[model samples]
Target chain A: MAEEVILLDFWPSPFGMRARIALREKGVDFDLREEDLLGNKSPLLLETNPVHEKIPVLIHKGKAVCESLVIVQYIDETWGHECPLLPSDPYERSRARFWADYVDKIFPVGRAAWLSTGETQEAAKEEYIQGFKTLEGELGDKAYFGGERFGYVDVSLIPLYNSFYALEKLANCSVAEECPKLVQWAERCMQRESVAKSLPDPHKVYDFLLVLKKKLQPQ
Target chain B: MAEEVILLDFWPSPFGMRARIALREKGVDFDLREEDLLGNKSPLLLETNPVHEKIPVLIHKGKAVCESLVIVQYIDETWGHECPLLPSDPYERSRARFWADYVDKIFPVGRAAWLSTGETQEAAKEEYIQGFKTLEGELGDKAYFGGERFGYVDVSLIPLYNSFYALEKLANCSVAEECPKLVQWAERCMQRESVAKSLPDPHKVYDFLLVLKKKLQPQ
Candidate 1:
């Protein structure tokens, strides 16, 4: 019997989407449990991730893995021979990990800026633009962050690109126009069956953000 | 002949210390090249880590690995069988990675609070206390973050403990008194030869911070 794998996630969470894309790409059989971020969380989610209380927990054979990148790496390590997210060479793997860590560090800051309101929002926007531009400079001419391959770094970053449309609408600035190569890379990723199936429409994500903003506002 | 591993680093940087500690623990013979944070950095440092010209950069066999955690992982992957920073099991590795990622996320917020000077500093201190309390709660009775063995998570977090004394002094509160388990764990980590040799003295770290504060202050 195939070992049971369960993912606790929200459909719109990029972190959750990372695991879904990896599973889909690898053709792994798993069960998905949708989580409502606003409502009372399931005991499983709370018990599995006592520290963070966030979604996107991957349970494989009863062991839980939290953090999207960590879970993705776990998937790669366990099923590395099937569909390799990382490279065979240790050095290449290190570089892939480096870029993935960079994405992890900056993504939150950018997301905060993209989703923020008022002065704090404006400050976050500035930080986001700076981070995006820096990333663009680093990317320069590569087909993917890993260069010519949609490897671990690409897997870590591509899902977040789905939010660019929402950020563009909210921040009133087009990331595509500013960083053409990133947009091109994102477009390429969107064409993949895994990405296409795993992510919701950009407009839907934007609408979700709007609901979030309204709910967060002081009454 | 072993390939020359050149480390681009700044003293008193916990991130840089992560790499240093890993290298020392692995007993990997490497050349250390210090980078001036306030002055001009070497062309090698900038060229090696073009995206974020921040230290520390580990140049092994002419390939550069930036980001402290990534470099530490690389060191472990390359040489850990000799002194195993990460566990052999895939599940355990994933758990270690998750805690390391959690530390990465929360460390900055804690540091920000620890370094603040006035009324703003109070809020940052509260944030740090809250973060530490949560960590203590999660840690429970574990000897190390990676369970009984002192592995990758310990290496990743131990150096950051150097900042605690300065933080306590700055915040006018004792994290050691508040979170006794965490403090004891950190103290136990200091007993390791590699950790003790590599870590800077707490008083010296505070002195360095004082110098940094003066340099950063408005004239």
Candidate 2:
């Protein structure tokens, strides 16, 4: 039986990018249904993800998988014959899940650095930098967060690096300066066809954020 | 070599109870080191989980696993010879992860209902009930959130039910009244020795909440 996979997603969403990168890496042929998140979400998106009404919702053979990392794991497990995203060992898999979970935990702090204003923005930026340094410590001299290959934690995080330029512009911070090793890692991830093709241009993301910031902060 | 397992936890914590329940369900021998969250956290806890500095850390053979749900999954995988917490099927595992993630997402909303006051409390209570109803809809007559046997989602949520009595007192609501089916499911979970023995007394939890509420509200 043939498998049918569809992703309901918004472009420029790091969460959505994780699923895209995972699918691309697995060499899976899937349809992309771009969503209008700022406007009315598609009925398909709403019906598929009634609980959160959020993307990227991965519909596989009519079953909806919500949450980006969960969808990535689903894709990896389902198409595991081609490429394995997570480590096979239980301990290593747990470590992969741990780092991915850490990325989830710190996302709001990173986003707040760009989205917020004044003292809140200042505090968020400091915390975000600290978070990056912590991740740097984890990365160390390793080529990838997954160690040898571009795997789960890499897929989980590399997507966010797409918006780093935008985030830096808004927050007046330098991720490259704060965590040079992580910046090098991001550059390495960009060399991958899966990650490069999945991510939007950094300058375009920065331009989008300029408009978004006006809407978010107001004059 | 025998597995050296230790759980660093605080009583009355639903998150901590999850690890206890999972460990018990797996029939794994372990030590419990209670933390004084109100006072000083143990140096061991500090060194082990420096990132979050939170409890319910499962130290297996000297390696620490933080985050309650992640620890539960680790226990299930490490001791997978019996009592599999997560489903083996990729699709079902994805669904379990989705629901468990949903529970994690709504926890702050549920916690805030009890922690806040006046209009904020009212709003949080309303949101919390809505979230519970959403979960109830998902349960839909299943014996556990995992459908047949008590499994991942069940392990994820049953711990929270331990404080239902306390939450009810603080927010002036009844899970039995609002979510009758889910309340029944909670009762079924309580019959399990794993869940039954791990949870603290309901009245004791409520009394603890009274003290906590005074500290939180500070009239």
Two-chain DockQ for each candidate model:
0.75, 0.82
The parts of candidate 2 lying over 4 Å away from their true place are none
* lDDT per residue (tens digit) for residues A32-101 in model 2: 9999887899999989999989999998888889999999989888896656889888778888898999
How accurate locally, in lDDT, is each candidate? 0.82, 0.89
Best by TM-score: 2
What TM-score, over all chains together, does every model reach? 0.91, 0.97
| Per-model i-RMS | 1.3, 0.8
- Error in Å for residue A79 of model 1: 2.0
User: Per-residue lDDT for B89 in model 1?
Assistant: 84
Q: What is the lDDT of residue B24 in candidate 1?
A: 87
Model 1, span A1-219: residue lDDT tens: 238999999998989999998887787878999998888899999999988899899999887999898888888888746568898777888878877877777787766766676888788777777777777776789887777867787788887788888888877656677778788888888888888999989999999977876787646
